[model samples]
Structures are given as structure tokens and as C-alpha cells.
Target: MKLPEINTATPYAGLSPDLVLDAVSHCGLWPDGRLLALNSYENRVWQVGLEETAPVIAKFYRPGRWSDAAIEEEHAFALELAAAELPVVAPLVFDGQTLRQHEGFRYALTPRRGGRAPSLESTTQLEWLGRLIARIHSVGSRQPFVHRGRVDRATLMQAPMQAVLASTLLPASLQANYRSAAQRLDDAVAMRLEAIGPVRQLRLHGDCHPGNVLWTDEGPHFVDLDDARMGPAVQDLWMLAGDERALNALLDGYTQMREFDDTERALIPALRAMRQMHYAGWIAARWHDPAFPAAFPFAAESRWWEQHIADLHELADGL
Candidate 1:
């Protein structure tokens, strides 16, 4: 269950402006300022520009880590959304192979959006967001792991939670809460995963967290479809529920797009817990990976999830 921990900071820790500029030049692109690198759990992204007027981003991925199928899937999803008139960062031309392997590392290029990343700061805007959510969900659900079939919720939760429960390198409080929360929701979790309900799985911008959203003149532009997968309609909703006020605001806009039915509504709290628990567990298992920061946002999310688990349980039992 444990994977090698990576030094999440290694990519940016020693990034000097001169060195980044050098990388820009090496890539045959003019460096307007310096290459801005953003490293996350799975990928490395850098913003480089050929012109001072507007910057284009090129994301260099770790070679062989993401399968060619996944890259293709993401491209398809981005184009799908774009075709619907959604303003997402368009995919620019790339190297013949998306899996750029060199020095045991991989990389790729994708266009950067013109405007800034979207803020979850407004409620009224969320109503607009809800509409987007509805449109996204309505697109057509295709199973992520298996490309040939329609994806249902059961297929999504089954493996991830099993892997999550196996992770151990978590903080004591967070780990404790995870175990406790799992124990409390055992039945509902099992039922949800086992009974297998109707989930309108369409392509999703899998990791639709605030970090992946781009704010533009047109509206919200979804940037990272890396986590794109076939899953539940409100899976994104639970992820956004990390903050209640923002959740409410986004829901207001999202509902205007397509409202959550009563069952989907009731499952929100549990789904929120599911997202945190899954990621928390994943982080714990790899806490010691050389690629990770000894202390990273995963640990922070674990702590938050543990506390929220208790609160959600109290509310659930009361109901």
C-alpha cells in the first residue's frame, strides 16, 4: 500500500531565476520573466512565455508516470468542454509523444489561460458555477479505469477506499479520526459502494479543486483535467464543501445549472468525508516519500478531515 515518498519540494526548492530562464531558453521559448513552476502530488507544471504580451504555459510531466491513455483522456475532456462553449484553457500543439521521457523524467505542453485562476470567494458566482457543474455532469459519464463502459459510483469508491484504509504514515490525530470516521460510517459507506446506484458519469475535470480553476472574462475556466474521470455528479461538490460558505455559494450557482436530488443532497456530507478520507489516507501512506515535503497540505487536510468526520457523524446520528 505504501509507495516511495518524493521530495515534493525538490522541483522548486532550488529554482533560481537564472536557471529557470535557462530552462526556458533550452525549451526554445523566450523567457519573459522566469519560469514559474507549480508542483503537486502527481505532476510538475511551469509557466513559460514566448511573448511578453501573454504567457503560455508548458507543463513538464514525470515521464511514464501518466499513461498515454490518460493524457488522451484529458485532452478529449478538455476539447469536449470547449466544444460545448465552455472556456477552458485550450490544449496547444505538443510533442508527438505526450510522455516526454528524458533523464528519467517526462514532460508535456498545454496552453495557459489568459485570465487568473477563479476564486471560490463569491456565492452568487457559485450559482453560475452550479450551472457549469450541471453542464459538466450532463456531458456523459464514461468509466475512468475502464474506458468502454458507463461509470457508476460503486466502481469509483471501491478501490480507492480500500487503498485509503491501508495508508499509515499519517499524523496521529488525523489517522485516529480516519479510523473512527470509517468505523462510524461503515454501513453507509458499504451500502453506497455495494448497492451501486445510478450515477450519471460524464467526463469530469477529475481534480476540480480551487487550485485547478481559472477565472476569465468569459467565466470560470477549468484548467486541470488530469484528475478527470467517470464518477458521481456531486463528487466535485463534496470536494468543494471543505468550506461551507463557499460550498453554499457554489451550490447556488450550480443548482441553477442542475440541482442535486434528495438522495444526492443527503450524500453530500458523507461524500465530503469520502474525499478527505481518501486523500488523507493516500498522503499518510506516502508521508515519508522522498518526493514529498515532510509537512505538506495532505497532512493539513488529514487534520481537517479528522475533525470534520466527528462533526459530520454527530449530525448524521442526530438525523
Candidate 2:
């Protein structure tokens, strides 16, 4: 089922303050009219205050971005990880449903989890995160998502490259340059993946960047499984590893719970290149959304595009 496209410039225009309060109330929660917008561009997330209870997080899924089944699958994966005693924030089930709709919006409520960013410089922290991720993957490997996507050249690079090319955000004068650089990077990534051959693909947190990890005195807990999908285990590992030392630290903890595939290490550069291309393409595709331009003002600058093209070539050359 497709949701009606609202104003392209502000897709969440209809998601007004009143609508959010009412949506939370519909789920049997008493929102105290206090709403704080979270840092999210892909979805409209809010910290809704309650009268007698602590604040709860309300995440309104981006319209038309994912099918109901795909969203439900993500919710299920989060729940599975949480159930396995992993540090994950799963959507709170309301009236036996994790995914709900109020008006035209599909939304979910999760208990608010607060913590600061994980310190990547701390080997102890990285090892703890490694263990957490390994445990999450242990559950992830047990089942495959039937509705979500997979991490691959098509989804991560090619389609996004097409989106960038179609977007008017990239200056027309630099379009040819951007395309050529993107294609070279794409080819390099493809060759690397082909050389790596088939590696074990499994369910992953998908976007395990440091921002998604909340570190506390206890250690770290992961948030945001929105990007969860089938992918190499390395996809989850590479983003968190900044260097060889960090990678070794992560693998040291990872092997405690699950076996690490040495072959997947070779896919890191390819994965990194795909992510770089995907990020630029994402901004281009979402340029119509006011949030994108406001959050990423540099993306509109020609210099940024030129630099991005140069970076793409550099990444390809490195591979």
C-alpha cells in the first residue's frame, strides 16, 4: 500500500504537533504536549513527554520509503535482538502490534533510551561494542528478513548513482565528471566484491556507525535498526573500525561470541566506497525535503560536488 505524497518540499508537513500528540494518545499513552524533534532525516522522530511516566520516543516512518512488511520485519528483528538480552531498543508493542497507523502515518513507540556517544578511541569500548554486535549477529544469522533489502552494489551504489544523476542538485557542468567518477568507483567496488567471491550474508544492524551506539557506564547499547537488512557481517563491523588496531579490537571481542570471516575484511574498502556514494546520492534524492538541505547545506554547493567526485576517484584508486 502506498501513502499519498504530501508536499515534496516538506513531506512531514502534515505531521503537525497536534497530530503527533494524538497519535501517541491513540496508542493509550498520555502525551503531555511536550515534543522534542530528534536528529533524524530518514524518519520523523520525537521525544514525547508523558504526564506520569518518562518520555517515550515516537518514530513516524518516512512515507512510502518502506512497505508495511519491511517495517514490520525491522521491528521484529529489533525485538528478537532485545529478547536475546542484547542491548537494543525495540519498538514498544501497543495492543499486540508494534507497527501502527494513526491517520495516514505509520508510527511506532519505543521507550526513550538516553546515553552519550561511544568513544571510538577507547579500545575497551570498541571491544564491548564488538561483543554486543556479535551477539546481535548471532540472533540475526538464525533467520533472514523476507521483506527487507540486502546490502549490494545495486542497492548501495548503482541505484543511488542513478538518483544522483537524475537530481538537479549536482551542477550540470559537473554531471559528467560526477558520473565518470562514480562509475569508476562502482567498477572498483564490483571487482573487489567479485574477487572476494561469496561470503556469508546475514541479518545486520546495517548502519552501525558510532552515532547509533549509545555508551553508558555499563557499556554500549545500539539504537536504530532502521537500516537493518541482509548483508555481510563485515558491513556491521567496518563502519565501527577506524584502523587496524580498532579492527583487531573489535574482532577480539567478536570471536568470543561468533566466528569472524577473515575474507570479509577484504570487502571493507568496497563497502566504504559504496557508503560514500550512497550518502551523496541520499542527499541528492532527498534534496526536496527541507530537512536535507538544512542539515547538509554543503551538498548544494558546487565545490562540495567537485570534492565528492574527487573523493570518489581517490577511493576507487585506493581499491
Measured by TM-score, the strongest candidate is: 2
lDDT, residue 209, candidate 1: 70
Query: If candidate 1 were superposed on the true structure by all CA atoms, what would the RMSD be?
Result: 5.9
lDDT of each: 0.57, 0.91
Q: Tell me how many residue pairs clash in candidate 2.
A: 0
Task: State TM-scores per candidate.
Answer: 0.69, 0.97
Candidate 2: stretches off by over 4 Å: 1-9
All candidates: CA RMSD (Å): 5.9, 1.4
Q: Candidate 1, residues 67-153: lDDT per residue as tens digits?
A: 667766666666666787876664654344333333333345566665565555666566676678777766634334444222332
Q: Which tens-of-lDDT digit does each residue in 1-319 have in candidate 2?
A: 7555566467798999999999999999899899999999999999999999999999998887899999999999999888999989999998789999877889999999999998888888888888888999899999899999999999999999999999999999999999899999999998898888999989999999999999778878899999999999989988899999999999998998889989999999999999999999899889888888889999889999999999999999999
Candidate 1 worst ten-residue window by lDDT = 148-157
